[model samples]
Target: MSLQTWLVSLFLLICVILCWSVSAQAFAPYPYDSYYSGARFRRGPLMGFDGEDTQLQQLMQNLKPRPTLLIRIASSLGCIAHIHMATAGEIVEVNWLAEHINDPHVKVLDATYEVKPKPNWEEFKNTSYGKFDELIKTHVNPNYTAEHIPNAVHFNLDVAYFPGQYERFSFYSPELFEQYVQKLGINKDDKLIVYSRGPAAGMLFAARVWWTFKVYGHRNIEVLNGGFNAWKSSGHPTESGDKSATQGNWKAGPIDKSLYANFDDLTNDPRGGNLFENKMSAINMLDARPGGQFNGSEPLGFPAPKATGSHIAGAKNVPLPNVVGETGVKDKSALEEALKKAGFDASKSTVTMCNSGVQASMLALGLARLGIKARVYNGSMSELALRASEYINSK
Candidate 1:
């Protein structure tokens, strides 16, 4: 054959091979070797193609990659950057609150409530720091005066509800909430920072108070991230006495319906209440109850007439301990991972429910840190068990 013809044939063959290889890489299932392939595309190699080709790179830049699992779940779930920016004012770190503790307009509150089985006081008697009887009466029972942040008032969740409400810790009526905070000397304009004793349940309790304040239309409210433990561990000053203050005019603002969810919302939900089986729900109904309780293997252990062992029909168990870690709410990545592991769809709206709405608030707080706004089912499993027993799912 002639030299010119042979050269043209060889060049055409090489070009065809290159095109085929590019097509295969571009369409192959993305491996983890390079960032351009898997979840988010970076416009470089298709699947770890080491060689740089301007045509291939430009083609990739124009090609749309498949959305990540989380992105496919929901675009409204928000991203990590959005999460960090959004979480700034909702929770105060220990140092920030310490610096502002003395500010007059800032009101710090110890919203501590015990949800565990009663501790045997006799065991702590000898190892106690001071007079055993006095300690048990004042400190052990959270209802009374106790050690707290300096200038911080005690917010007793036990009696925060209206007289005729379902039970203790049921959401308070607007008028009753107004009277409750007024008695604590909180004014409408006060910038409230609520904290609790433990990182898990305590933080949840504090979040519940924060949620309540938000529900009543209090604009300037936040939770102390790590609560009392964070404060004490950081060497922040704490006093062992009740805070005394004259009443300030705190009126209940119009209720913010968006933050609170009722039983009917659950029944009307599109998730159809069983993410555990179907895994394709428009709403992520999270049950913050422990695994045993969720599966009906363990009792709720509370005296309330609430159903002990079951969850709302469409809920997935995420548990309180998983939501709140040793350092308050888990970091955004960790929380997202935990929720994802529980079959959470990042793009869907979330409604959190627990035994008494406590852990739900905790999960809400964690979701808040992730920049995902979630509603709390204030009439949580307690109301569900009593009113909508049909929706309760037992293993």
Candidate 2:
């Protein structure tokens, strides 16, 4: 062979070796036994060249890539990078989930909790539990059983792991949260992609699931942008029937307090004087409800009893519809514009609340996309409406 051809071959070989090394490093298990994307391989026999590494064997068996030199190289470099950065952002594109849908390391969850309030809601104003019961039968259950993203697990958030004696919107206890996660077959290091279809084809309930994961110290999770509607619109695949997952060994870590705010934190904090009355204060309280509900012009939302259209007197109304676009959560630039138009003060500490905790999480997710972290009031207005008379009168 000519000397020039020989040199070219040497350069190509070096690139291949470097790419392989990077791929292995990208997949290697992190310290503290964390996961990188979903590739949590044991540290042994470089990429399992020894042929006895069970993890490597499983990986190879699971991924039946085309047997071509170029394909192998591309798979190593391109595909590994894709997996490595799968959960890097708060949002993942439909195309990315489509490409990695079959990877064992990637877990997709459908967190759809469709809310259907009655047309004449005042008749059942005091029966929030009945509304929830009705939605489970008519909306949430049927939607998941009828169609969902291929291989997506159903994350039943409303009542499955709920505490028995709290107001209906309470966060699950740490133990119950752990049990729920493990049952979903989630691993500590798994790349979780959560999606939901809103009443009008927007992304809604998934943000609460993402927030719950973050609250329990799991960071490798992303919301599927545009949600199930986006997947269908793009002509990706779907599954009609429910499927079971092998239970995962996933355990909950210590709660991350910064991501959560309880009722006491909102009511008693020295920095907060804004929950009961409209005032300029240290914290920015953004209510993710429509102007009508926030200002007492419309009927109460899903489960807020007694207080039809009543909100914390201090909250600036930043509706969920404004925070999320027609498809999903707005893109970064659009989100920033919306927040600005809604008079969101980025400098102040933010606490988001809606009727329940659901819409608040969507606002929190939008703030997160803009690199601003905000707390979700787990109790939200339901808790507030139930007990507001106690605090509102005292304050």
Clashing pairs in 2: none
**151-185 per-residue lDDT for model 1 (tens digits):** 88877654464211332255555775677688778
RMSD of each: 18.7, 10.4
Q: Write the per-residue lDDT of candidate 2 for residues 276-317, one digit (tens) a residue.
A: 553536677788877887676675544434443365545677
Q: How many Å off is the CA of 290 in candidate 2? A: 1.0
Q: Give candidate 2 regions above 4 Å deviation.
A: 1-87, 116-140, 160-166, 273-280, 301-309, 390-395
Model 2 TM-score on a 0 to 1 scale: 0.70
